[model samples]
Target: MGTKWITFDLDETIMQNPFGKWVFPEIVNMLKKETDTEEDILDLIVSEHLQRMSEERFLEAYDWDDIITGVAGNLGAGSVIDIERMVIKHSESPKIYLLEDNMLDYLKRIKEKGFHLAAATNGYSKYQLPVLQKLGLDRVFDEVITSDSAGFAKPNPAVLKKLSDDGEITAHVGDRIDHDVLLANKLGVFSVFIHRALPAEVLAYPIDERATHPSFIKICEEKWHKENRLREMPFLENECIPKVVVQSVEELAEKIGFILK
Candidate 1:
């Protein structure tokens, strides 16, 4: 089969939406209660959380609980419970927004090449669908399938299989190497990894802590969660790496061998 269908990962693959805006400031204020807690220290903690989200090795050494525990350090800080509560609250109900506007033109270009487009994301309808609507992409995407709708998440094989049951030449495009690429590769479908711009918050985050200003965070959350799942499933190998990797969508058409008008 040729490339007749294209599936995308929503959060960072196309859009960069961060949840828990309250998390950073709240943690900073609480940290100051236990110790002098310079903004630099809080920035370090924020950077750690981000690294934990992106890098598997960093996550293995520390998690959200570890970060908080390191902060309080046996002072019996009552704020621990409050902080955990805050994380849980915002994490469950994230503040979703569209960070990239260029995906529309990219999707339109692919669609014009006679390929159907679908969004296969591991997010909730309440949150994910609204972002698409806000970006005016709700109608543009042929179908939107989320974890809530799919009853399975990525790397599950079931999610990709469900999409393939429709019998179309499918190509999966996402930012995460482990999640989108692994899933597509597992299913023997053409996979493309689009290295979208990193969030500004991540790039501008304090010095040395950041690799570079991400030119791009829930996107980060999704990465962390996906990494955790991959870790748990040790048997799963990334046997199928992406066939192509492009920095932007404009470069996607030729890379994927799709011709646009």
Candidate 2:
């Protein structure tokens, strides 16, 4: 094979998107209950977003108790641990989005062709595997590697370098422009940018490929349910790259084939 292996970013590329949005509303309610307020939740939301926007330390994952107190104080929620309990109890779901259609078939074909697949993500394997299991991509991926696993995140060439030695063709797919597309270019892999959970402004950044279809969509209702919940990351059509831009995994697979063959 010309391209012996391919790497992937886990969060928005293959499964449901996670922007901490899911936990926002519940946090607001918790703030209100704890602080005793009939006020709208927007204050709480703005407070939280600003709080973690690079002023103080920002974390991808956090404990329930610390977050509640900080957010409550920021938004003037006033002593709300019980509400924190409510938010923690129902804040997140391990079950996330799955693939769209015919994508899984394409992966099976690639696997039959003897291509290697690995997930190089910024999250942890333990947390991400559950998400993959929910999407059914967990079992299919030959190797699963993450920032938590590797001790670093995207835009870092070291993670991509781990996929293969020099002289082998590698392809990377992901949703973030700055993190995925830009980094892959530097790492010398055929890179794809996904618009699943992005916005027009952010997506306008150029990527080697603009992907429109899921690489591993399955037909099961459980899979479909997850797809429905995928955060709508969008992009501008004007985004361009020196390489070919494609909309489906079949297209990506073909590109990899030509390069590797």
- Best-fitting candidate, scored by TM-score: 2
* lDDT per residue as tens, model 2, 71-166: 567666555455333433432354245444666666666666776777777664544565565556766787787765655556667665555663
Give candidate 1 regions above 4 Å deviation: 1-3, 18-101, 197-240, 258-261
lDDT (Cα atoms) of all candidates against the true structure: 0.60, 0.53
RMSD (Å) per prediction: 10.3, 9.6
Location of the lowest summed lDDT over 10 successive residues in candidate 2? 213-222
True lDDT of residue 157, candidate 1: 67
Q: Local error of candidate 1 at 244, Å? A: 0.9
Candidate 2 is scored at a TM of 0.60
Error in Å for residue 22 of model 2:
4.1
* Candidate 1 accuracy as TM-score: 0.57
lDDT per residue as tens, model 1, 1-261: 643668888877776433336655676667677566444656666566656545433312224456667656644455553544554444422354444456687778778877888888776565466557756678778888876567666655677565577767467888776668777888777777665564556545542233223222234435545555524433222443455555566667544453221
Q: Give candidate 2 regions above 4 Å deviation.
A: 1-3, 17-22, 36-95, 165-169, 195-242, 259-261
